[model samples]
Structures are given as structure tokens and as C-alpha cells.
Target: MELAVFLLRLLVGILAFPVYLLHFLGFWSNICKKLFPPSMVVFSAIYNHQTSSKKREHFTNLQKFAGPSGKLSLLELGCGTGANFKFYPPGCRVTCVDPNPNFEKFLIKSVAESRHLQFERFVVAPGEDMHQVADGSVDVVVTTTVLCSVKDQEQVIKEVRRVLRPGGAFCFWEHVIAKPSTWTYFWQQVFHPLWFLLFGGCNLTRESWKTIEQAGFSQLQLQHVQTSPILGLVRPHIIGYAVK
Candidate 1:
């Protein structure tokens, strides 16, 4: 019975790892919106759940800050599957970019199926290397849980600033390394190598907030909201807006 149980677990791992790796490598970026529909649903549910009291308070505050209106031209970098489609106002035009060509397939399908919002265009190229996108063309650029994986983090932030028009907002929610926690640091140092290898280039120990600041974000407002209840391995979140 023990051997049978072990075999079952191994089989599940074998099947799951390849799928996980494909998504991580952005190899499946095109089909990702459809391939991970269930995960998209789950993430949407979580975001929607934040509509309650405490979460709603935070949401309302962010909404005011976001200035959601018809005139805003938004750009989402590494917009995996367009999970935040519901966040934008209906008439606000959005442009989505992902480095991997795979995003074209999945994002196109997801965008077509969704009723309310529509993207102005979906491009396949690294947003950080924004030669393809015209300069000062964007009103706002957003990234979520994506900065940790980029190979050239600084370059990307500079690109975000470049693409955004004057007075444009760049918003993000990213997980970064925590300070004064030696134990968590040690674990992150150890696990990050393997994690990066298997799950794309995501390192948990990056100082993403500082990176954003250094990338010429002149008007910056930051929020370090805690994600985990436990002491160690807390995903100290960086959420806020930076303006060019």
C-alpha cells in the first residue's frame, strides 16, 4: 500500500511539473489563458472576494488613486492571460504585452470571450525592450507578481517609465525579500536557485521596490503590505503607484 501510494504521488508530480515549467518559461504564453482557465478563475475569485469590508476599503482607496476613467490608455506588461481584465473601466483602452509569442493565442481568446473590456492591441515582445511601442504613448503601465522573474529588472522599469506619458502612473503588486529575518533569507537563498530553474527566473529575494525607485520613478508612493500571517517567509508586498 505504501509503495502504491508513492507511485501515485510520483505520477502526479511527473504530469504537473512539465505543465508548470511550460507556463513558467513563457513557452505556453499563447495558450496560457485557455490552458490555465481554472487558475484564472481562482485568482479572479480571490480578487473578487476582496470586495468585503476591509478589502473593499482598500479597494475603494486604490480605485480613487487609479483614476479609472474612459480616457486612460493603459499598458500591462507581462499580462499573463489578462487576469485583471475586470479592473479597468469599460471604455479605457488597454494594450497588453508579453515577451513570449505564446501569449498571443491565449490572450486573444480570453479577450474575445470576455464581454466588457477589450484591448487596443496585444503585442508579443518584451515590454522592457519597448522599441516596438511608440514613446510616451501610454497613460498608465501596470505589472503584478511579475517583476521577480525578469532577467533585466532595471531595464524593464526604465522601459516602463519611457513608455508612460508625463504624469502617467505605473502600478504594481510584487513580492519581495524581507529584512531582519535571517532565517527567511537563508531559505530564499537556498530555494531560489532551484525555483528559478524550474519555474522560470523568479527569485523571491529581489528588492523590487528599490528597483522601481531607481528606475526614475520621480513621484513614488509605496505600501508594504504583509501577505502571510507567519513570521518567516512572509511575502512583504509592494503595492502603489509611481509617476514619470
Candidate 2:
């Protein structure tokens, strides 16, 4: 009887594996979107620490072509919970824009922790339309892991270009679609429908960098890298700068 029960429990677990994968993949990036407002803090903490090292390097690259840290005006599109706060250079003024209003509390906490940066106003709007920010006024625009999930990649890139100063730079780090040959790539394509449904429209197959390149940026210094993030669909990433 005990052996029979053990086998039955195992069978149930096996049956539910696909559903579990659909909901919990990509370090729970999509799962948190479905979480209750206040409870998102726990998930935010897990995500912040989980990808810290690699993201830190990505953040560091933002300052490379930034020219001068002091007196610089930086804009970050999709600044989710201010995850990149600590990495920003001191003395720079920042403007954060995101559609999720629930992140205000989380951003407040992170802003307090990131003393080096000057806390500019948080704009509640989508990246695709940042009309509140005037044209050619920003020194730098930064984003990390944002492009994969936006409604319109082309519009967002156009907005990024429109707001930057003549010599300003746009820095980004985002996951891209993988090649068709790999096992993870197969799963990324196969389970995409379920993935998007569970993750709030976050698509794993978008060619985000391609859209940016064609956005008429004068120069693009981008590089692609494969990361091991437990979920293959969100592992292959691109990080670099596009100068206007």
C-alpha cells in the first residue's frame, strides 16, 4: 500500500511539471507580475540578489560612454523596483519611468539605500511613450532586461533616441531569442504560448537588438552572451551602447 501511494504521488508531481515550469521560469520574473502588491517585496529581493554580479557588470558598462558622472542627466526606462540604483554613479540626476505603480514603495526603499544617486521624480508611464521627457534633453538612457517585455520595441527605441542629447548614449542589457539548435531554444519556442500567458506578455522570442539597430542609432557597440540562469528561454543576453 505504501509503495502504491508513493508511485501515485510521484505521478502527480510529474504531471504538474509543465505547469510549474510555465509559471516559475526565468527566475520568477513573470511570476512576480502575477503576485500581490505587497508580497512582491520577497520576490524582488530574490531577483535583485540572484542576478546581482552579472547585472552589476552590465550597470558598470552604462558609465563607460557616459562621459562625466557629475551633472549628468540619466533616464531609465522600465526602472523596475530601482534594481539598478546602487550601480548608478553619484552626483548624477536620475529619472525613472515604469508602468507598474506598485513598484513605488520598492523604489523608495532602494532610493534610500542608493545614497550616491540623486533621487529625481518617478514618472508613471510606459517607455514606448515618454512625452513628459522633452527631446534632446537627456545625457544618457539606460535599461536592463526591459526590451524583451515591452509592447512595441520599435517605439521604445525611437523614444530612447528622441530624448537623448546629440551625443548622448543609450545603454541596455536584455535577453534575446536563442538559436534553433539548442535544447533550451527548442523549449523557448515550444512553450512560448504558455510562457507569455503565465508571464504577462513577456515574449522569449523577440529580436530586440535588431529593432534597436534599425532605429537609426549612429553607432552600435553591442555584444551577445549566453548566461546560465536556470531558465534557458531568458539566458542568452545582449549588452552594449547605441549612440545618437
> All models: lDDT?
0.67, 0.77
What overall lDDT, based on C-alpha atoms, would model 2 receive against the true structure? 0.77
Candidate 1 residue 19 C-alpha distance from true site, Å: 13
Stretches off by above 4 angstroms in model 1 are 1-70, 228-234
TM-score of 2: 0.80
Single out the weakest 10-residue window by summed lDDT for candidate 2.
28-37
Compare the candidates by lDDT and give the number of the best one.
2
Q: After superposition, how far is residue 180 of candidate 1 from its true place, in Å?
A: 3.4
Q: Write the per-residue lDDT of candidate 2 for residues 1-244, one digit (tens) a residue.
A: 4454456545654665775565556644545564533454564466667677877777664554454433778999988778778777777789999877777888898889888888888998898999999998888999877887789998899899999988799998888888767766666665565556555567888888889879898888899887657545788888888899
The total number of steric clashes, by the backbone 3 Å criterion, in model 2 comes to 0
User: Each prediction's TM-score against the native?
Assistant: 0.72, 0.80
Q: In TM-score terms, which candidate is top?
A: 2
